[model samples]
Target: MYLRTLYKYKKWLFWLVTIVIVIQGIIFLKQGAVATPFFNYGMYSEKIPYLDNYPVYKIYANGKLLQGNDFSIQGWDRIYVPLLKFEGKDTVNAEMIDIRNRLLYKLRLGSLDRKNAHFENPDFDDQDFYSWYRQYLSCVTGVSVNDLLIVKQDYQWNGSRLLPGDSLVIWPTIP
Candidate 1:
């Protein structure tokens, strides 16, 4: 009787797992690569060449400009995600910058792309990604979400180092 019950439930378990995987795949497709970090099944990604130059932009939170330490998420968010996002992009003409800045810039650029329906029309505060970005800002800024205001500004490279680019807000009001 127990063996028969196990055999009967095995099919259900398999179906349940299959359904979960299908759901995950659907979400992954809709949300761009950021939504899911599943194992890559193809070898095409490995064939891509490395980029020496990448863009970097200034970020501010709550009117206070953020430093590199704030944006830095040791491994996953800072490095790996950018690598994944820029795998096939045109990088040859990009101005060469430090590796860390390159990755951070790519991650921010990926956030700007409106790939998911949820992230589209970003002015509405109730969206999942809006909330997520606010939460991320809170973490990076050490400020409560209620009081936080985020901005991205342009930074010009003046020969040896980056200088404020026009002192203009590039991303004025999160959208």
Candidate 2:
């Protein structure tokens, strides 16, 4: 009788365990997303030395300015910047592809372009890349990928200012 009862409850127990596991996974994955880290080493090239010199910016969250080098972000609000609504359109071609590759190679070391001269990231999915590029250029500060829709165009891309420019580089430091 006891074994029969236990067997009858097996399905419920399995579902309960599955739900708990999924919840745990979500929590762990979210923590990792919020704490994504990057190194600010002395890369060979520097268009803007703003990051190289400053190396660190205080983390801002929910209108709060935080200390330390650890930048935690989540959802759209996690990204704080002057949102620039990109609505213009552009064309995608070999020349345009090369432009972005060059920009990436220049700003970031170990860029995809550096691996092979003709190497283009096959994963560049913005089919209408020209529009994407236009939007990026329009941004003066930072942009959140989740907010890249016309219905919700907020124009304050703080991350844009975090890039390397022709004459300056700024770096972040951990406190």
Candidate 3:
């Protein structure tokens, strides 16, 4: 029964297999190129580099330290992902500018003008990010956040355990 069905769709199957093979060949030849639908496995073929230190944001809401162990994976993500994104806003802006310039150049619209270009960053510039973050945290944690403290701590792995090093309070600083 299966063989009869396979035989019936043999022509369609042949074309489908041929198209996939062609796409795979193109992806292989392109090397590091990002081809969606048919991905280049070369992207994951390289070994990830080892890092000596890892920076983590320790968030305290209303004098209580929020531990990842106490929350679900998604809950922890909601707590820290915005902080990571907000911290790298400048880097994101720079990449966005580069992308815009490349797109303009590709479409024969000339390069981006540093002084005159009206390019605005897609991410909203929140001068008082901590204030907003405090409110956001309140909503996420289901508690009123009167005080918020974000400590950027660098941790080093010493084979056995992670040792906390130099800490800096990044939020709620005195003027």
Candidate 4:
């Protein structure tokens, strides 16, 4: 009787085992490719194999980023992000920018009027850059998502961050 029951369910068991094997195979394939960089290293192009899904399309025209979204050029690539004009208040954070741009965008957040990016403490520095930056950033408190923000690197207040109103000019020198 037990043998008959086992045989009766043999087909179901076979398919179940096959499904599990297929899943394992896919996981293994992804793991094998885990060594690859998501931003796509080694010259920006589809010529590289198995790296097509890299999120950033890293626009290149005349061998430079002309305009781009959800992409990053390799190395110290430079971009002259047009001055992001502000229409209202906004809050800038790492997660929000990362999701918007599809990259881990880091920000130093300071005023274009300031010269540094450090939010200094008398104990930390003679001045606080973030505080100066907040004077501008805090405008986000009651503003719409369509506000503007002049972003810069964590130290260089020359403009590196991007907000909604800012039209990012993709054409810039590649680092």
Candidate 5:
């Protein structure tokens, strides 16, 4: 009875399966060219490069160190995400330019003449960011941020645990 029902709808089933396989094949072929969700199965299979030093951002609000555990996941993201973006702005811009050039080349369009092709933010003031971040932090954490200190500390992973190394004050520079 089940086999008869399946045979009756065999044409429909065949067409559906063919469509799905074709879509998957297209996604597999264009995996590196574009970011097709879930189709790039090898994305995480690539070995990650081992780095001796890993930099961590430590934020001190009102003279007290803010711990990650103290805040909710989203709250912690709010705290550190901006810092990461600000610190890695140049690297991010370079990556974006590379992606843009690759996409343009793939589409048969020539790459940008200017290497730095308006990607860099000229008006991004450090002092302005610091001031705005201070206010934003206060609002996000619900604590008055009188003094904000952001430090980048490098740590080395020794098999099991992380060993702390040199620290650099990123914000409120000490002259």
Candidate 6:
């Protein structure tokens, strides 16, 4: 009787295990590829294997490099890169720009102002981001917020290494 029951439900068990494995595999692949598409499941376009084609943003204030823990460029590399590429000149990118601009204006970093494929400011703009960044800078560097000269520099990555690239002036303070 037990053997018969097991055999009867074996197909259901097999399907359940298969579904779980597929979901786990998708997650693992997504992590490895950043914002990658799976059978066009999570993305509109086919997944590309170039993981290192992302850009890295570096922040410097008062001629001193800021700590990466305080602000991360992962969001740009993970979320924005894929969207910008797939959506092109769609409303999604515009909305993202607007959100970024609002944050920049609040942080007094100036607007990110984009022109064509280039960003005029490239400087990040987020309020909660600013709150923590300001506090972190104050505590870590003991530098007054007004005296810091903040700037953002972007580097292109080629799956393995980063190359020299664009620089944006975020905060200009006289020395």
Per lDDT, the best of the predicted structures is 5
The C-alpha TM-scores of every prediction are: 0.32, 0.16, 0.69, 0.16, 0.69, 0.31
CA deviation > 4 Å runs, candidate 4: 1-8, 32-175
Q: What TM-score does model 2 achieve against the real structure?
A: 0.16
Question: Residues 88-143, candidate 1, lDDT per residue (tens digit)?
Answer: 23223133224434555678865433334432333433344335555666664557
User: Candidate 6 versus the native: TM-score?
Assistant: 0.31
**Backbone N/Cα/C clashes per model:** 0, 41, 0, 23, 0, 2
Give a tens-digit lDDT track for model 4, residues 1-175: 5445654789677666666656666655564322222222334544744421222223232243334342365211322221221111122333443443432223434232142233211332212332342333234222222322322222212244332332333223124
* Cα lDDT, all candidates: 0.47, 0.39, 0.78, 0.33, 0.81, 0.51
Cα RMSD (Å) between model 2 and the true structure?
A: 17.4
Least accurate 10 contiguous residues by lDDT in model 5: 31-40
Instruction: Check candidate 6 and list the clashing pairs.
Output: 52-159, 104-125
Q: Candidate 5 on 35-65: residue-level lDDT in tens? A: 4442657756778886899999999999899
Tens-digit lDDT track of model 3 for 70-145: 8899998999899998876752466667766776779877644453245553445544677788899999999999
Q: Which lDDT tens digits does candidate 6 get at residues 129-157?
A: 34445555565455655444445455666
Clash count for candidate 6 is 2
- Given candidate 6, what's the lDDT at residue 65? 63
Candidate 3, position 33, lDDT = 42
**lDDT per residue, candidate 2, 1-175, as tens digits?**
5445654789776666666656666656554222223223335644753333332222222234433233444322232231222112122245766666776778875356655545444544343443454344235224333222222212322565544323211111113
Stretches of candidate 3 exceeding 4 Å from the true structure:
1-45, 90-92, 110-126
Task: Report per-prediction Cα RMSD to one decimal.
Answer: 14.0, 17.4, 5.1, 19.9, 5.0, 13.6
Which residue pairs come into collision in candidate 5? none
**Better model by TM-score: candidate 1 vs candidate 5:** 5
- Model 2 CA deviation exceeding 4 Å by range: 1-72, 77-119, 123-125, 128-148, 151-175
Residue 111 displacement (Å), model 3: 8.4
The best-first sequence of candidates by TM-score reads: 3, 5, 1, 6, 4, 2
